[model samples]
Target: MAEKELLRISNLVASFSINGGYYAAVDGVSLQINENEVFAIVGESGCGKSALALSILNLHNKANTKIEGSIYFKGRDILSLGLEELNKIRGRDIGMIFQDPLTALNPLMIIGAQIEESLFYHTGMNIGERKKRSLELLTQVGIQSPELTYHQFPHELSGGMRQRAMIAIALSCKPSLVIADEPTTALDVTIQAQILDLLRRLQKEMKSGIILITHDLGVVAEMADRVAVMYAGQIVETADVNEIFSNPLHPYTKSLFASMPDAYRNARKDQRLPVIEGMVPSLLNMERRGCRFAPRIPWISDAAHEAVPQYHEVKPGHLVLCSCYKNFYLKSIPRRVSSSTLR
Candidate 1:
């Protein structure tokens, strides 16, 4: 059975102006999110994960940000909509749970009022009804004392509690789509698990599509239905969650798995955790042609890469960006792996 498509982003380019020049942070990327599915985008920092999320909501500052893309949400082009027009959909039909609760939440307002703001704007609910719904949302997200938490300001809550409040706000309208950008970044392990569980439960209940942006593959394995491995503003690999875990085709994707401490412990305790050499290129310096990951994996021959890399479908629903993945092997690691054994 086919899942219902909720959002479709086509040739999305989110660029930032630097020194009078615009540099594409999210360059020519496209993907789809379906109803009742969690689509995870995983990559290291500065790989344009957040940029893509911001572009979805048109949240970037227009003065310095150049976004050329069609973000079709429920058949409407979000990029083409004006601020007022976008506002009608921002928190009503689509919601966002931002990374840092401290920064994302308005400190001045109490939690309940913050959630109510969405209800006020989107739903024709009175003050009494909004308050009632706010408390319900707070309780639904696992706040122990909904009444007390409701009146308390964002500064008064713990990191986990603040994150819960953010979740409440995001789900207040029962949106069909939610963009959760690093929802568990600063939390501890136990709290992270709890948060993930809460999100999973809520998503199941709502049956909404989610764009979960994070660098943690562990979170992806646990929560994602589909996964996209991003590298320097482009998707290098994408597949069903099982396929990504079992057979990560892109060299960058394999390198990410190899870097995980658990992968080393599971394979051989003596083996050092493999690290991808070199940082993601600065936006201004990022190569716009060929395989963006080639420089980081210099052992692969130039002939292995396409001048302008395009997606190669290795199997149905599994896509790898370039031919370089076929010949990729970490020079530092003693073992050389074929495509089948890359993971």
Candidate 2:
């Protein structure tokens, strides 16, 4: 049986103006997150992963950012909502676990108050009840000594503990959809595992859909049910997590796998970890037409690329954006070849 859809984003384009003209950070992206599943978006630093996540709730500054298309959450178009209406949905309906705990959490406010802030705005609980709920939330997120942790300020907690506190706050309202953006970014390997585990367990308990935005494919492998690979402000491929790992089709996806350290265990001891050549193009400089990845893949003929490429399913439930992936090769040119040569 198919699970109920929780959120549906259609032809969403989030654009920000450069010096004068605007460029898309999320260009005509469409996706859906089912109830009780994790939909992970993975890409390199400048590939607009974070932009897509923030755009879901219309969180960008309207003064400069121009958002087009619809973001329908539970059948209502979130893009059309006013601030008062959107405020109600931000925490209670859709919670966001921001990447930086230090910046997201208030230094002056006690951790308990921070959690209670969401409760105060969203729920009609009394002060005593709110405090009790806050304590329970801290405990639920795996923080030991919830009472003590509640009284401490955000500055007092360790990096891992602070991140846990952030999780506690996001889940305090028991939102239907949780957007965890790079939740394990700066943490050590051990803490990263713990954080991911906690998110999985909490999602199962709360029965919430999750939009996990991160560059770490390892984390995606551990937690995501499905994955979206983004590059140059557009999603290049999307598939079931197992299928993405086992049978990736996009050239960008293939290049990313080659660059991972764990995928090259059998290589020569002196061989360096592979790298995807060419810096991500500036948003202002991105081509207005054709495949966004065309510049990086020079070996493939121009005819291989569609004038306006769009995702087509290559396997069941797996979509690749470009036809040029048909005969792609990572080693078409020698190692250390320059981007100029590729062009």
Candidate 3:
């Protein structure tokens, strides 16, 4: 049987006006997240991953930007909702934990008060009940001494603690869907692992779907059931996490894995970490036709630049945007080549 989709985004096009012309930051991106699944969006900087997230929540000011396509949540089209409808959904139905905890939290507000505020606005709970629930949420997220941490301001709490508080706030209303955008980016490795574990636990307990946006493949590998790799404002590849790691088909996907710090370090003794050759092209110059990555493909001919390749299934349930390049590149070239061999 087919799994039910909790969220479905199709042909999403978003743009920002810069200088004198418009730039498409998210171009015709489409994907779906099933209930009780962790879907990840991975890409380098300026790949429209963040833009896609913002579009789903209707966070971008519509007056200044143009957006098209559908974002359906729970059978309703979110893009078609009015301000009041969206307000009712945001935080209550779909919660978000942004990248920076300090900035996301109010410095003057107590952590407990911050979480309670959501209840105050969204629920009819009195102050005492709100506080009790807030503490429970804080404890649920693994904060030690919830009472003590509750009284602390954002500054008094450590980075990881603040992040936990942020998570507690997002989960205050028991939202059905959570969008965590690089929630662990600023934390240490140990804290990152803890936060990921907390999210997994919460997802399982609440049966909520998650959209996890991050550039870290390691995080995706650990947390995501399904993965979408974005480049130049488009999804270049998407598959199950195991399929992505074992058989990444897009050149950009392959390059991203090759550029990982661990992979690069292991591949060479003293060279700088492997890097994709070209900078992401300016969105202002983005073309509606053709693959946006063709310019950066190492040796592909100009003909490859003429059109965007239709997404192809290399295997059951594993979809890639470009032609299969692993056989052409991986098998033809030795895994380890000496400098003399290149010459």
TM-score for each predicted model, relative to the true structure: 0.95, 0.95, 0.91
**Runs of candidate 2 exceeding 4 Å displacement:** 263-265, 268-270, 332-343
Question: What pairs collide in candidate 2?
Answer: none
Range of the 10 consecutive residues with the lowest summed lDDT in candidate 3: 326-335
Tens-digit per-residue lDDT, 269-337, candidate 1: 566678888789998898888999888888888999998898999998899998888888765665556
Can you write out model 2's per-residue Cα lDDT over 91-173, one digit (the tens) per residue? Answer: 99999999999999999999999999999999999999999999999989899999999999998999999999999999989
Regions more than 4 Å wrong, model 1:
263-269, 333-343
CA lDDT of each candidate? 0.92, 0.91, 0.87
lDDT at residue 290 of model 3 (Cα atoms): 73
- In candidate 1, position 65 carries an lDDT of 94
- Candidate 3 at residue 69, lDDT? 93
Winner on lDDT between 1 and 2 is 1
**After superposition, candidate 3 runs with Cα above 4 Å error:** 263-274, 304-306, 324-343
Q: Candidate 3's residue-wise lDDT over 184-211, tens digit each?
A: 9999999999999999999999999999
